[model samples]
Target: MKPSVSRSESSARCPRCGNAFDCAMHGQPFDCWCREMPPLPADRLDSSGRCLCPECLAAEIARVAQGRPRGA
Candidate 1:
């Protein structure tokens, strides 16, 4: 038999909201702004060497989207 793990056991905090929650704890990975605004390459690493929180990441996305030119 195998053992199970909880989100908190490996979950990360939401950089935007500062709320702690697990996004990707398993071996799977996904696109997350918490890691970067545009989301750095999968191989890239954040300053903290860990994934960023969802809240902070979302805020960054919104900010960038707003900064874009009207035509862009």
Candidate 2:
């Protein structure tokens, strides 16, 4: 079953690391912290299409920007 997020929630579990973190996107994508960062490519998304925490997201962006392959 899928996890349920409350409309007023401000945090979420990171799909990549299973860590609970503050997620501005929990209730507001447009104002999320991720909005200020580079967007993750389609191939980097988890199978469930959930957003990653800032740490994982930044790592992915760095990996791609530095010409490293996914998971490398």
Candidate 3:
């Protein structure tokens, strides 16, 4: 279930860290900013449909590269 983003920007919180962030997936002049990040592995993608903050997202990608399980 993709997070219920509107046709414009919205304020959101990272479900993992509870950090506040802005989502611009459907904002003016551009696509989502997460597109800037490398694609996450299908198995590693979050199931919650909420977007992760940059730090947590980078950590997740690193964990995938290191072959570590989540939270390890």
Candidate 4:
């Protein structure tokens, strides 16, 4: 498995775009905005095992629905 990007508590830089964004995945509540998003497809994961920022995630979802892969 690939190592994940380093992240501070409640803060992370999106591994894909290097955009700094607030992340609550490991926070007290454990509820995060990503929970509301559709699960990304396994093939689309790129096996990076890291999270994307809001804009990148949204764009990825759209790309998948349109039968396009990342960087296409």
Candidate 5:
């Protein structure tokens, strides 16, 4: 089953560590932890409509930027 969305604000979960938190709580700009890192594809949204966390998103960005192939 999908998790219910909260009305407080949007948050992100680390794909690597499975840590869930708000970007603002982490002193970030966007509503997700990935705010401090980089932008993602238009399809990265979760069922509840939230972005991935910074660490997970950053790693993906870095891997792509480095041309290290996908899913690195």
Candidate 6:
């Protein structure tokens, strides 16, 4: 049988910025810090389903906000 690999202690490269950040949900989704944050918009997602680091996520949010109508 193949050994189970745990990503709980691993780091992933942010698809947006390429920075490596520790992922709380790598193998523990329910215990991840990201579970508490608002979901990212569809437009922010790329072909990859990888998670973005806090900084990149924030930048993406800001970019979206800037492109929206003032009253939106």
Best by TM-score: 4
- TM-score (all chains, Cα) for each model: 0.43, 0.73, 0.73, 0.74, 0.46, 0.61
Model 2 CA deviation exceeding 4 Å by range: 1-8, 26-29
Q: How many backbone clashes does candidate 3 have?
A: 0
What's the distance in Å from true for residue 65, model 1?
Answer: 1.4
Tell me the spans in candidate 5 whose CA falls farther than 4 Å from its real position.
1-9, 23-36, 41-50
Write the residue-wise lDDT of candidate 6 on 1-72 in tens digits: 232233335677676556776676657444665666666677667657888777766666666768862213
Which has the better TM-score: candidate 5, or candidate 6? Answer: 6
Off by over 4 Å in 3: 1-9, 28-30
Writing each residue's lDDT as its tens digit, candidate 4 over 1-72 gives 233466667777777778777778778888889889987888877576677888789889999889896756
Candidate 5 residues 1-72, lDDT tens each? Answer: 233254335465544466764556444443433444666554443456544556566776777668675565
Kindly give the stretch of ten consecutive residues in candidate 2 with the minimal lDDT sum. Answer: 1-10
| lDDT of each residue in 1-72, candidate 3, tens digit only | 244443333667778777766777557866767888888887777787778877788889889889899856
* Model 5 TM-score relative to the real fold: 0.46
lDDT of 3 at 2: 42
**Number of clashes in model 4?**
0
Residue 21's C-alpha lDDT in candidate 1?
Answer: 61
Question: What is candidate 3's CA lDDT for residue 50?
Answer: 76
Scored against the true structure, residue 72 in model 1 reaches a CA lDDT of: 30
Model 1: pairs clashing at backbone N, Cα or C within 3 Å: 14-53, 14-54, 15-53, 15-56, 16-55, 16-56, 17-55
**Candidate 6 — what's its lDDT?**
0.63
- lDDT, each prediction: 0.48, 0.75, 0.75, 0.78, 0.54, 0.63
Where is model 3 poorest over a 10-residue stretch in terms of lDDT?
1-10
Write one digit per residue (lDDT tens) for candidate 1, span 1-72.
122233565567543344666665343476433343465333333456555555545554555557742223
Worst 10 residues of 6 by lDDT: 1-10
Alpha-carbon deviation at 17 in model 6, angstroms: 2.1
Per-structure clash totals for the candidates: 7, 0, 0, 0, 0, 0
- Maximum-lDDT candidate: 4
